[model samples]
Target: MVGAMSLRPRILSSFVGDRFLHSTPPLHQLFRYNPGSKHVTLQLSRTLSGLTNLLFNRRNLDELSNNKRKSLKPGKVSPRRPVPGHILRPPYVKSKQPPGIASGPEVHDEKGVEFMRASGRLAAQVLEYAGTLVKPGITTDEIDQAVHQMIIDNGAYPSPLGYGGFPKSVCTSVNECICHGIPDSRALEDGDIINIDVTVYLNGYHGDTSATFFCGDVDEEARQLVQVTKECLYKAILICAPGVDFKKIGKTIHDHADKYHYGVVRQFVGHGVGRAFHADPVILHFRNNDAGRMMLNQTFTIEPMLTIGSSNPLMWDDDWTVVTEDGSLSAQFEHTILITQDGAEILTQC
Candidate 1:
């Protein structure tokens, strides 16, 4: 098959905080590691300025030694709409409210958000279960099996399972991999870090979530990357609300990561996911993102994939897994949220 397409180019600041990442041309290279493993590190330069990219040199992984790197046909998505997205399954359907939540603030179409709440709770449950399922001998495929049934048992569907023909239900991105890591026969080893990206479909709507967790004993850098990446997600949320500039979110997140000299991956972005798996109002986590206004009722995921060295990612031949260009550990956290009259409600909440 043809390689995965390169996404639209983006504009980002020169320095996230102290690490001046501004170069007229993005620095790209291929870094090598274990010959039998798919976990290669990268030394990527920030490539988030502009919207046009050639299909052949997507992330420009020239410095790395991997020959399988190639551009992909970018996935097609709706950029904006009056309403954000939903999880209510069988699309174009309504909700059946539960008890207390129905009488609360979400009365008229208010309870409609419950599906997201349910997705969040279940996602948390799944995260909890998946974390427990990790071990030195367990395979990623086993992890996927557990995550898949957890959704079914909760009367929900795994959103990633056929999303744009994505083969897995949960994204299991291990060390050195940025995001979109598919489950495989690979077993966990000592001191490994894996990030699980989960999205559930409930009541016709969608709930998106992701968290990087420790597999066994991790390195100091790995621990810091996971903690700071998650902190960046929450910090980005703090700057989110109605009428807020979308670019500031990235600026704040990048600034925060820069303080630690962390690398913020620029390849993939958090997007609107609700009634549809992925929706309008794409949320970019780096500065200079050409994002529009964050109007009321707008919903999206604010996931920032941070790298240890630089924020560049290169795709493998399978056209899915994305690894850091600098060969450093990467961690990310995501939340599906909605913009309220005041702040924002994390729909995937308990």
Candidate 2:
């Protein structure tokens, strides 16, 4: 799971007869038509009014129709699944409290690097297996069950299970959900998109990664959003090396997402993952000038969240689930990487 930055909740309300709202067309007419596909693809034109924009601090939703598909509803979360007694668990499991970001970079020696690679490979393998079960009728809870079994079968603990009170072993974010979506009993439908985040703890190290998968036949616009979100992650990774300014990651991701007019989520960020679930040097996905530098042999994750509509997030009552305020689709991709002498090595690859 990606770590979240502290944020204040904002009130959401639309004022009728506002100049900006009046000037904009209805949600249905705001999309750009593609002659090849019957579906209309939305392109954000302007942000909401000044007052509302400042209050929400997100793009104008003038282009998004409030009457889009039904908003995602929370389903009943299953009882917590048990792990085998023989499997070693992370320290946080016993505390039942969130172990906040540890205060240091995860720079590793040669032996530590080997351990990191082992955990990362396990995480990637579990995630790959979880993707194949993303069909129309399967519940996210079922996917969690499979992932949990796979992780323990390999003698590793599922990292998200007890951290910060997360109920499930993995995170299943569908459609508008930005991140940290708890796996539940809701069955996916055709055209729905889901992001499964998998992390594993092995030999005192942690590996984290995630990717969005199409449930079935997805629309062209949603497909483009997922594709660009992935490109944003790789493009950001390409620029990482020893002595590079960390701010360059934000610029690289923000610049590419701009070409497709996708909104980059700002609150959640990637972080150093090794001995701790979340570690030092918070990695921001949007444009910023934060002061930090990459060091050789250091490790961290670079997951980027991109949206088709407003990047503003509304948390579900469950507290673990986060969704787009406008109910538009959001997609994310993540990978744990090690900064090498020349470039970064992707630790979480199958």
lDDT against the true structure, each candidate: 0.61, 0.78
lDDT of 1 at 69: 21
- Pairs of residues clashing in candidate 2: 47-60, 48-60
| Residue 107 displacement (Å), model 1 | 15
Q: Say which candidate scores most in lDDT.
A: 2
Off by over 4 Å in 1: 1-108, 289-291
User: Could you tell me every candidate's TM-score relative to the true structure?
Assistant: 0.71, 0.84
